[model samples]
Target: MPQLDKDLISQPELWSLVMQLSDRRLTAALLPPVDGEQMILSHIPLPVATAGSYAKAVEEAVYDNPLLLSDFSRIGLLTSSPRVALIPACLDDKAAEEAFEATFGSEACVSLREPTWREAVVVSDDDEQLLAFFRRTFFNITIRPTLAAMIECYRADGLWVSCEDAVIRWVYNLDGNLMAANSFDISAPEDAAYYVAALRRVVGADRGTVYLRRAGASREWCAAMADMLRGASCPVEMVNASPAICRLGHSGADLPDYFLQA
Candidate 1:
């Protein structure tokens, strides 16, 4: 949505800062914003570059602009970013089930199946591109933690964080930013410890914190993991990012009277 686009455009420093926090896609060729209902292909940021035109934008001045204009008509740079999937009740009622072979001026596709209880999958089109993933509310709510870090990056660092379900997250905190992110599997005990151990390996001796969501209902195992971290001297918290910030195009409209009150 343009909401995020506009926000990023206004404070690109935050956007740049987040990359330091994660190994996110490192480039973006800007483009004109697209209104939701427009006939544009899909929900994506950055404009499509012309055929082999990555060469043209390699110079000065024109490349300095935050927005780029070209006539590829079908291919946009930075469109197929590696995306992470999380399980949240936010989109729980969402029933999107279909393997779409879509062409969103780039690449966008998903496998749709009603999540069994709360488990999902995340795939990658490339090491730098998030290919396919699911967001099931009943599963481990990973999006908010990563998203929280993203929002946090917007304020102090341009570092970004995201997950590929069950596996540890890919953190692009900074060149010397030794932070780590992981989406622990909440359904099992062994996996949770394994997740923390993986985190230890990733963050090394850096002062790092672990975040988990208590939404969608988790067992004491999650809290146990938190305690285990404390015993190991790792700062850990069960942070909640529910109803987090309101995203554009989400949530049904409020009652008509609410609008009238204003």
Candidate 2:
């Protein structure tokens, strides 16, 4: 087992526990209540085989990390699923459910309305047991789609991309309003760049910065993406994690920019 953060265990109520569940791994960050630093940044690789195995993997990971057992002031869970869609916020409950089912083909979903974005984010995952485990373990756990955080943090006119393993999540904001929030599965940097260019053309965003999250991305990948975007006259900028979201004693030098923006 890895060394646990003493502060996180000793003063659990002073911090906020944030966990991100993605297709590749489960990332957990113990952040301060306000704009401070992170107490712990840890992750465990998730088995990609089945949902039952996934729940079991998460259970083992939580048990392995003693700090995760602490009761924090706030708990947020970000679910990174490709089965996420954005619908108008004005839709009624039945209408929203129909829309979600039309796209995702299932009713096992959670819809969150973001008044700022003027849309509702619908995230669907078949891992009911995994979600149940989280609800059963934590109190008042706030679960949301990962893209919702990007939409909240980045409120400018640009393209924000977060790369992780074989998945690429992106949000396009135009004139300080969210226009698109989506993800794609890619095998290489070029595949992401291609989608970026295509989105720019489709959205008519000819000249806006493309901010890439510095965490979980390689220098080579960033460089290649920058090179590709340069042809479209769009400059690519790498955004680092906020200083307020740093590690316990050290700076959040290696953390993702979207740590706890939600």
Candidate 3:
């Protein structure tokens, strides 16, 4: 159970809630109304090795902190599963399912088209209970792939990487065209640097800058990444949350940049 501010408990309609569920943890952020100061954030770790544990953890968190039960102006649910495949939007349901299974072994999944990028994103997770829980608990909730927000935020010509938990989601744009949008599991700074270098080679994006979103990474880790990229002649720049989200006043200065997504 996490402690939340009093005002947030009293007036819920004035805020917007964003919840992100990953393999290792679930994160929830309460975005206050413009110029308001009471913002709340919570992170609950999931027992990854057990089946049906994700939903159990989420239910426990909600039970402890009823703030999650509040009715907000809007709610966004983001899933950060690594088992994601991006395909052309023209594919039909059957074809999309085939494509997803070909890339990742056959599994239950959902496919949604991202109109902004003109591509269809296929996401698969084995946790059926977790999906059911959200559907039963929240009203009019918008479920989206976390990659969609990352791509929406970096629509220019550059390489962008957003580090959250132990996963790094990256996108590359060249000449206003999206070259790649994918994620990788990284355990060390060296691993991240290696992926950046490999992605540059694979995408031929050797000249543009590398933008990094230090969502859940530490200062020491970010600094180490910057040093490594600079040594490779790739300029590194840190990206913060959207200006609109910043204006709403967040609990942490280093909140993930994908909160507002535009």
RMSD of each: 18.9, 3.1, 2.6
In terms of TM-score, which candidate is stronger, 1 or 3? 3
lDDT tens readout by residue for model 2, 95-114: 87788778877654644433
| Candidate 2 TM-score versus the reference | 0.84
Better of 1 and 2 by TM-score: 2
Q: Residue 177 CA error for candidate 3 (Å)?
A: 1.7
Clashes of each: 22, 0, 0
Measured by TM-score, how close is model 1 to the native structure?
Answer: 0.30
Tell me the spans in candidate 3 whose CA falls farther than 4 Å from its real position.
Answer: 1-8, 36-38, 47-52, 111-115, 119-126, 250-252
What ordering of candidates by lDDT runs from best to worst? 3, 2, 1
Off by over 4 Å in 1: 1-123, 126-187, 215-219, 242-262
TM-score of each: 0.30, 0.84, 0.88
Indicate whether candidate 2 or candidate 3 has the larger TM-score: 3
Best candidate (score: lDDT): 3
How good is model 3 by TM-score?
A: 0.88
